[model samples]
Target chain A: MIAELFAGVSTRARVLLVLLAVVMLAAPLVLDRYLVSVLILVCLAAYTGQAWNILLGFAGLLSLGHALYLGLAAYISAGLYVHFGIGPWLGVFPAVAVCVAVAALLGWLAFRFRIEGVYFALLTIAFAEVARIGFDHIGFTGGAGGFFLPVRSEDQGQWWNLRSGPTFFYYLALLLAAGAFLLCAVLRRSRLGHRWLAVREDPEAAQALGIHINRARMSALLLSAGMTGIAGVFQAFYANNLFPSQIFDISRSIDLILAPIIGGVGTLFGPILGAFVLAPLGEVLISITGAIGLNAPGTKALVFGLFLMAIIAGVPTGLWPRLASLLRLRSVGR
Target chain B: MTLSLYLEVLLQGILTGLVYGLMALGLSVIFGVVRVVNFAHGEFAVLAMYAAFVLFTALHVDPILAAIPVAALFFVIGWLLQRFVVQPFIVRPQHDQFILLVGLAIVLVNALLMIFGPDSRHTNLSYSYDSWFIGPIIVDKVRAYAAAAAVVVSAALFAFFRFTLLGTAIRACADNLTGAAVVGLDVKKLYALTFGLGLACAGAAGAIMVALTDVTPMLAPSFTLLAFTIVIVGGLGSMAGALLGGLLIGVVEALASILVEPSMKSMVSFALLVGVLAFRPQGLVGKPA
Candidate 1:
């Protein structure tokens, strides 16, 4: 069934997949552990951004509060492990469920009140901030002290268990990143994706055309939240810690969005390409500047902002669309 | 704490809210006229604090005296930013200007961070620490002075908009860009001047901030959030809303601190924001939505 589905995918997507496979296979050998860690971070960010792209980019429902799901998932998984002896794999589903529920609640409230555009964005942010503060105050989540996953055994690999070495996690992250890209690619070409784009272009027109905007948006929200939850699970296992201040922080959400947004929002490979290139470069910038005796404050964020601005100013169509045009490759729709 | 202590905190919060309102007034002015949210508005205040610190340390100048030149310098910077950076994208996609301003904010903050390390700088002005006693209540003199300065600046700004030709032009530009352009109101100049005015308000706010709290690059980010919350609560582009909203937040924050953990004071303002948004999005004293 999957093979037949793969067969239907275009040549461009196939080429991109092969390229990603090549990079995945070659990364650990070519890159240093630090660089690989940065790559891992990028993958994590890209995955989150891709997840966000489903709701915000594709569905035209902007959510500035996606970090809430990410953080909540991380905390849930980490908290489960810390208290009960349940490993991350078994705990992942619950995390996703919790995040989806929360996302649904937000979507319900937003749709009920008909909060659209900037107001919706602000409300999402407010909700996330509320969750952040709530989590910060709650003692079960370690309040402000943060929750940590114990590192067990430094051997070859523990695939069944989550706490593996960076090399092990790197491959794991690569697999997940590939999964995120595939999820987006699959979603973008589906019937739902068409409805989403229609609604995004014109909500009233989409409604007139028999597309239910709320239903489409809510579905997008759930999928987006679920994907972000999965990424959070990956992040918790990979990092071996979850801090409310760090994970649920507004800055983290912003960081996650910057890559996909600057790379090319709503595109399938944008997050992958964006995270793969930008994440490592940003880490390098920070480390290099630190080495050169210049105190850089949020250099990554600054760079991301500038990159976003430059993209908006110069390449409004985004890198992938421009790349597709240059390479004479054609997508099915456009 | 005790009831009296609680009451005292509430009183202090009301005073602090007044200052917040003043800061929001600056943000409101620019947002009102230009319809562009200056993400770097808080940085103007930060820069002012830094400038004040420099003057106080180097030349032994009073902080207030230093603020005048600081505000003037910032006015020019703000005007230039609007003219060069912001004007090009005013008619483009809405998100473009937002992204540009966000980028500019990052650049400004990072540049400031590079110039001045992350350490908080205190402008140890001699009379800044003095306090006035009102019966049983005590008010920090610097805070009172800062609050008073905010009131004066806000009043003057209100008057400027109400009485001056340029002010009316700026208001006109704010109301309808195309219409103002049609009326030959120098829309571009008005936008730049409005931006300058916003920064000038921030500059004054910064001088007051130095007198009350220590100056640091990180300080502006929190103030940005506070100011944004105030602006939203006060009404998106209402000067009066900004004033009332700031004071409201300051009081809520102070009271929340007394009731709960001091660190959670900000959380209180955030809570109020959410509540207001859910029930009354336009704010308490705002015009029709």
Candidate 2:
């Protein structure tokens, strides 16, 4: 089944896949520890971007509230770890369930009232803010102070799943990114994907074609929320901390959308490509400028601003779709 | 809190809301005429506040008196911005351009942040410290002036939209841009003028804000979010809706803070946005179809 699935992928995608796999396998051996951390960041960002794209790009649902999922998941896992002495691996279920429940409530409100377009975007943002405020007041989630995960037993040699090294985190992130990519790929070929695309193009037309537009949109939203929730869990485990102010921030939501949007909204590789180009560029700019005794402030926001402008001015079609066409990866539509 | 203290807080809230409403009017005007969100609208208001600050420090001019020239200058800048940056994308996919405009806002914010560090500054008009005692309410002089200014300016805008030839042309564009174009209206000129008018409102609001409250570069985000909530509550394209919506939001936010906590005031507005969006998407005073 896996080989057949692989066989159906385009030649360029397959080649790129092979190249990525090779790189992932060889990165720890070849790259410096610092570079490995950077790559791990790229993976995490790519994962978040991809998860975000599943809703905004494919379903035509612009959710500026995704930080709620990230923040909630982080809090859930971190709280469990701090309070119960539960391991991160075992705490994934409750975190995911809570995120899904929150997303479902939001989705219910949104879909029931038919809050389409920019209104939907604003609604999502409002919900996220509410979550932030709620978390701030709620003592269980550490309130305004935030909660941090206790570090596991410090043993570089132990591989009993609580791995702590940069290499271990990098590998874990790589695996997660790979899973996200594969899931997106599978979803693109699924019935739901076609339905989502149809609704995305024109809801009335899709409804005329007997597709349940709302159902499709809601499903996409839930899946996207769940994926981002997992990313939050991963983030908490990696960073071992969760702050309400930082987690449920509007700026964080903007960051999630920026990468996928700058690369390509709907394309599978857009998030990864965007993360690869933008994340390290931001880090390098900050480090280089800091080294010269002048720290570049707002470096990430500035670069994203410029990137968004360039995409608007120079390439109206996102970088990934345009590049994909040039490389003959696939046609514009499935 | 005492009942009198509660009344005092509510009155203050109403005054604060009037200022908020004034700020939102500029955003509504621009959004009504141009379909663009004007992500840089709050930054322009902040810049105007800075301009007022300069007027206070340099020429020792009153912020209110300085508002006229600031409004005129910003009108021209806003007009030019529409003519150049916004007009081209009037017919195109505005998502990327909207992001670009947000970029412009960030640049403006950081530039101001760099020039004027994060220190908060407010113009201290000597008489502004005085208060008026009416029945059980003690309204501060500066806040009262801000509310009074909001009423006068909003009423003037209302009259302009309702009566003037140029205002009618702008309203025509707001009602239907393509239809106005088809009717041989100078759609481009009207758009620029509308944008200018919007920025003028922002300038006026900023002048009032400086007189009444502190100013800072960090004020952009809070002001932006507050304006968004007002716009959502007021209805996107309706001038009358903005005025009514502003007062309503202001009162609700004040009462919420009294009943709840101080931090919940923002939550109140956000909750209003969400509730209005879910229940009455057309907004409180939106024109009936």
Candidate 3:
């Protein structure tokens, strides 16, 4: 299946992909632990960005509250593990299920009311804010005080429990990123993907052409939410702590969308390339700020803001398309 | 609980909501004229609050007095932002514009955080504890002043749009952009002026809010959300609706905090926003799109 997916790729692109895969597979062995962890973050961001790209880039449903799914999934999986002794391997199922259900409800409310464009985005934000405040008050998920996962020293290498070190997480994240990439590639070429493109380009036109606009949008939301839920499970186990304020903040939602946007929205490699550029750049910015004795907590975000503006103003299509064109490579999964 | 307590809360909500309406007024004006949402509307307000705080701390200037300079300063900043940053992307996709404004918000917020630290700051006014008693009701002096100032500013804004030629031109552009352009109206200058006026309102609102609440970089996002909620509930682009929505939200939140809990205030407002969006997408006073 993987080989078939890659069959349409040109020779140069195929070679680049093969080399990239090999390097990623062997990265943990050569890179320092800190760098490996950064790679894990890149992978996690890529996974989430890809998920977000489906809804926004493909289906033209701009959601400013994607953290709703990510936070809910994290809390659900963490709660299951903390209370019921359910491993993340099992917890992920329920997490994704709940997120999909939420996406269904949100999509229904939005589409039913004919709330299009910016209003739809605002509605998403409202839902996320409601969830954040509701979680802050709810005692079950530790409320504003935060939720924590116990790190059993004995379960050091337990993959099922997600109680492993950086290497394990790095590999898991890489696998997820790669899987999402393939999934996105396949979906982009599928009938549903075409329907999404049609709806995104012109909703009324698509509807007139006999496409189920609501169903297409709903599918995008559900698929995106479900994928993002897995990333949330990864976040819970990797961080071992959850705070409603941090996880469910609009910033988190913004963070998820940035990579896809900066890399090139609606492209297969955009999220991955964006994550690769952004996560490490963020780490480097932190180090530079530390070295320069600028102990300001807002420096990274400030730079990110400037960077986003530059990208939008300079190359609105994002870096991926620019880089691809500069490199003279035929765009894949367009 | 008691009727008098409810009345007090109602009054408080109305007073606070008036200021909230003022904060949202800029957003409504900008959207009405330029067809662009200033996502950094709250950050601009926060910046004004910091300016007012600085004026108070450094020169011992009263925030009420400092509001004029702050509003004037913010008007220039808004005009510059619209000309240099926002103007280029005015014709871009809505998503692109959203990203551009969101980026500006992040930059403004983080810059404030770096400069001021994360600590909450407030003016140490002599009349901070002053209040007025009317029969069985107690009105906080600061809130009354802030509300009065808001009313004055809003009245001025209304009069400008109603009576001034430039305001009429801006309204004409809002009414028909192509028609305004065909008639030789410098649409771009008018847009920048509209944006400037909008941020000026935010600046004034922020200056007044310093007396009621602590100023912090963290408050930016919530303020933005609150402005959005107000505009949506009041009906986007409707000046009267913005004020009314602000009062309605302020009252609801005040009553919610007293009746339920303080943290649930945002939840109630969001619920109101969602309810309004679901039932009346055009808002209470806004004409149907």
- List candidate 2 segments past 4 Å from native: A1-12, A152-163, A292-295, A325-334
Number of the candidate with higher DockQ, 1 or 3:
3
lDDT of 2 by residue, A1-334 (tens): 4565576568877797799899888989999988998899899888999899899778888787899899888888778877887766877788988888888888888888687766677678788888887888888867888876666576444444344788888888888888898888888778898899899888999999999888999899989988898888878877877787888987777777777877788888888888888778878888876777542765445556666766766665578877777778754422
In order of listing, the candidates' clash counts read: 2, 0, 0
Docking class of 2: medium
Here, model 1's chain A TM-score works out at: 0.92
The better-scoring model by TM-score among 2 and 3 is 3
- Once fitted onto the true fold, the runs of candidate 3 whose alpha carbons sit more than 4 angstroms away are A1-4
The CAPRI classification for model 3 reads as: high
Candidate order by TM-score, highest to lowest? 3, 2, 1
| Worst window of 10 by summed lDDT in candidate 3 chain A | A325-334
lDDT value, residue A279 of candidate 3: 96
lDDT (Cα, tens digit) per residue for candidate 2, span B1-289 = 3888888987888887787788889889988887788777788889999999999998888887777788888899999988987777787655555666766777777677767877999687878779999887788987887788877888888899899998998888887877888989998898899889888888888877898778998787667777778888989877777777778888888898879997767888888887887788778888543
TM value for model 1: 0.92
Top lDDT model: 3
- lDDT of residue B51 for candidate 3: 94
Score residue A196 of candidate 1 by CA lDDT.
Answer: 93
lDDT of 1 at A61: 73
- Model 1 ranges off by over 4 Å: A1-13, A29-35, A154-156, A296-300, A332-334, B1-4
